[model samples]
Target: MNALFFVMGCVDGRLVLTLEETADMLGMALQTAYNQIDAGTFPIPLRKNGRKWVADARDIAEYLDLMRKEAREAHDALKRKLAA
Candidate 1:
């Protein structure tokens, strides 16, 4: 949880991140990150400067946590239902 909070607060005010950095952080392919952004599942980049797409690191981290929590809850609910 502290780690998550750290990532969320890393950028002081703006959550800035380059496409390559985000891909590395998320362990995803560079193109996959772009595709997810294109599909609107991921947070949108605030600016496109030249060949780069920059996103808010905080938003991305928070969004990732939200998705993870949702998935965990769903799986736990499923397990409970199966046990009952």
Candidate 2:
């Protein structure tokens, strides 16, 4: 819908994303995104351009795949715990 289009526009044909756009895409607060970047635990590697942080779409996709795997593992673990 309209929301989807808005999110898509956040990244251009170059696949570049600003810190705020990346935070919005990741569903986290802007401050939290900065913290994660500082801690080096963000979903993907970001490049610093002056005072802003930038992310690539390919990296974000990879991060999503990694998160999906972790989620599946956690779900399986919870099911086992409940069965026991």
Candidate 3:
């Protein structure tokens, strides 16, 4: 699923995502997401909501945007280096 779509859907009044949604947005298996949470490596900051983990939709969107920006910058740099 497109990360922007997922995030925008949530931004329409839904401020948090369940662990499963978070995993899908990150393109990781649910188990892997849980493992990452346990290992303290989940890319988006999460918080405990009763018995489940929840993440802010805005945080996920911001993280994805940052990653996309960095990737684009890296690709541009590589092109420049290759052209030189």
Candidate 4:
């Protein structure tokens, strides 16, 4: 299967992204992204380079897939419970 990466403005070289780029790709505010990273609630882990936070696009995509799988499982369980 293939993975989908939603973030743009990146060259074909490195898959790294700045916090701002990650926030834009995630449709959230910059501060919110930072908060999530700090709170350890972000989908993927980030690396701190001196004073900046960076994320890997591939890791983010993988995390999204994992979240989708979890949500689907939860929804299926809920449907089964309701049907019972």
CA shift at 76, candidate 4, in angstroms? 0.4
Candidate 4 lDDT at 84 equals: 100
lDDT of 2 by residue, 1-84 (tens): 223344455565457778787788778999998888788887768898898888876666666666768899999999999999
lDDT of 1 by residue, 38-69 (tens): 88875534568687777667656766787688
Could you tell me which residue pairs clash in candidate 4?
Answer: none
Estimate TM-scores for all models: 0.65, 0.68, 0.84, 0.68
Tell me the whole-model lDDT of each prediction, alpha carbons only.
Answer: 0.70, 0.75, 0.84, 0.74
Relative to the unseen true structure, what is the C-alpha lDDT of residue 42 in candidate 3, on a scale of 0 to 100? 87
TM-score of candidate 4 against the unseen true structure: 0.68
Which structure is stronger by lDDT: 2 or 4?
Answer: 2
**What is the overall TM-score of model 2 with all chains considered together?**
0.68
RMSD of each: 3.6, 4.7, 3.2, 3.1
Q: Output the worst ten-in-a-row residue range by lDDT, candidate 2.
A: 1-10
Roughly what TM-score does model 1 have, to 2 decimal places?
0.65
